[model samples]
Target: MAKQVCMGAMMQCSMGMAPSSLVPTPKTVMTSGVMAANIMDNIPIMNIPPFGMCQSPSNPVVAAATAAALGVLTPMPCVPATPAPWAPGAATVLVCGMPALNDSSKLTCIWGGSISINFAGQVTHDIP
Candidate 1:
């Protein structure tokens, strides 16, 4: 039988290289349909490009695992309404942060246009 590893235990463990532990504390925010991107709450400000714009993990391994474990934890790619507009619909946006304690009250959007996108999944800070 395959050994089962509990994500909670790993996260809580004192392991040095644990990817999950590297994630910063997440915060919840409400969308106001504003043009400015809502900065991720309680995370280190590291400009890592694309992912940095959304305050996601700069490490590829951590990023992939985080995305798999916590669905919609990263910004998604979207076709812009124009060729190169800085508007919300014109590009990908990070409307959600790392899930915590089975809650995702932080999920939000800033897309200001007639276009709409749908994402479905549960949030969990636990990573396996």
Candidate 2:
């Protein structure tokens, strides 16, 4: 009797498809998977911080190849008599295509490499 009823239902379903169960569907599953992937892709971009703004100077500060040299090379508010690990102010660095330093320049430490200022001084940067 049960088999007969199932066969009858199958025949009816073949003629006109029965309604799907009111539960999980393929669209819901695919949407969830895509949403999960999208969330993961966004995480890394959010973790990135703005250029030249690190928690400490020890961290790398990635910036454009060309920017205001003073802001990119040194800390704000000029301090005299201090030699930066990489470059120092009042020391000649190529500014606006000519070697110059204004009163606004200050001691600054770059992550790596050294710079020598002619008729001035030299700065060495030691990177770990």
Candidate 3:
């Protein structure tokens, strides 16, 4: 059904308008095609790219824009701010000595948003 995640994997955010791609460094393991990623690949711009625009009110930019628009929900450019790793990762499957990133993995955005994996980077020829 699902499989491991790799670099350039498509990702989305709950408070984001469009999807973005994952940018991992291939810590522990890497697939034949694209380098596999782990939970440690949760960096801000280095690993996670922007998701079009952000719609969360908690974000300062969005908040300011909404305020300027007279209480209207005005979205702003997305700037991912994840300070931790993907939760509930494959603990048993270590990548770069850390938990391997799974397709169902979820990353949190500090601006009140949840990032999710839309599709793994690899098309075929993967371990699982």
Leading candidate by lDDT: 3
Worst 10 residues of 1 by lDDT: 1-10
User: Could you give candidate 2's per-residue lDDT for residues 1-128 as a string of tens digits?
Assistant: 00100000111111111211111111211221221011111111121111222222232332222134643543322111113221122243332232232222222223321112111111235788
| Backbone clash count, each prediction separately | 1, 0, 2
Runs in model 2 lying further than 4 Å from the true structure: 1-34, 37-52, 62-128
RMSD in angstroms between candidate 1 and the native structure over all alpha carbons? 17.5
For residues 1-128, what per-residue lDDT tens digits would candidate 1 score against the true structure?
11111111112111111112112222243222211122222222121011122223543444575588775445333211212211222122343432222111221212221211111121236568
Alpha-carbon error at 31 in model 1, in Å? 28
Evaluated against the true structure, the overall lDDT of model 3 is 0.88
| Residue pairs clashing, model 2 | none
Q: Write the per-residue lDDT of candidate 3 for residues 44-99, one digit (tens) a residue.
A: 98899899999999999999999999999999999999998998778578877788
